[model samples]
Target: MKTRKKANFFPRFHKLFAVKKIFSLLFAGGAAGAVNGLFGGGGGMIALPALERAGYPVRAAHATALAVVLPASLVSAAVYFFGGVPLAVLLPVSLGVTAGGLLGAALLPRLREGLLSVLFSLLMFAAGIRMLLP
Candidate 1:
């Protein structure tokens, strides 16, 4: 009987952190944090690809990106709160986001990799085009 070595899905995480890779990851994370702080969104756009390039599988990368961005999002929200952005204005949007997140989580496991990639690309492209428009 032949035995196959189990693949390490996050190889970069398992090994000793190299200085170059550490800098690259930090740069990516810093950029994502800055974007989140400035725009109140879009951090996942920068983090997902960075994590994927660092050897995470697409699903793992997406999940990890959420974890990575959560703290930044919280801090950004805190700033907005202190800046007197009305909590009532955010309440409805927050409810919708929570519902959508539940639906997305339920669908993620059943989604095909190709379909997910195409959807993600289209979303990013649409966001870019929208941002570019007057």
Candidate 2:
């Protein structure tokens, strides 16, 4: 009686998974960057989960998302500035954002992971609903 040998497929499957992961990473970054440029914020809404799925802890993901958003925000702001957006409209908003951002950053580490996720989801849901309205 002749026995058929089975091929080892795990290595090939692992490589395919790695490739898919890389593509997901790139897609996440591109989406985040585009959102940042177009909306002036909300990149973090895209990036946070991406970072978390890429193996960062909840808090670390939030912080990393902020880090990614910062440069994109700056570039977008720079373009608006050079394109004649008024400092009168920008400065006060920027100051408020800075203060609020500092407070949120200080608060992030104090929150539990589940609470953070719930709050994040709620905020996103609210924003989505708000955007749907006139």
RMSD of each: 8.1, 5.5
* Model 2 clashing residue pairs (backbone): none
TM-score, per-candidate, Cα-based = 0.73, 0.67
- Give the runs in model 2 whose Cα sits over 4 Å from its true position: 1-17, 107-131
Candidate 2 positional error at 118, Å: 4.4
**CA lDDT, every prediction?**
0.87, 0.82
- List model 1 lDDT by residue over 1-134, tens digit each: 12222225435654656556678899999999999999989999999999998888988999999999999999998998898866687899889999999999899789897988899999999989999999
lDDT (tens digit, per residue) of candidate 2 on 70-123: 998888888876878777988998899999999997997797979787998999
In terms of lDDT, the poorest run of 10 residues in model 2 is 1-10
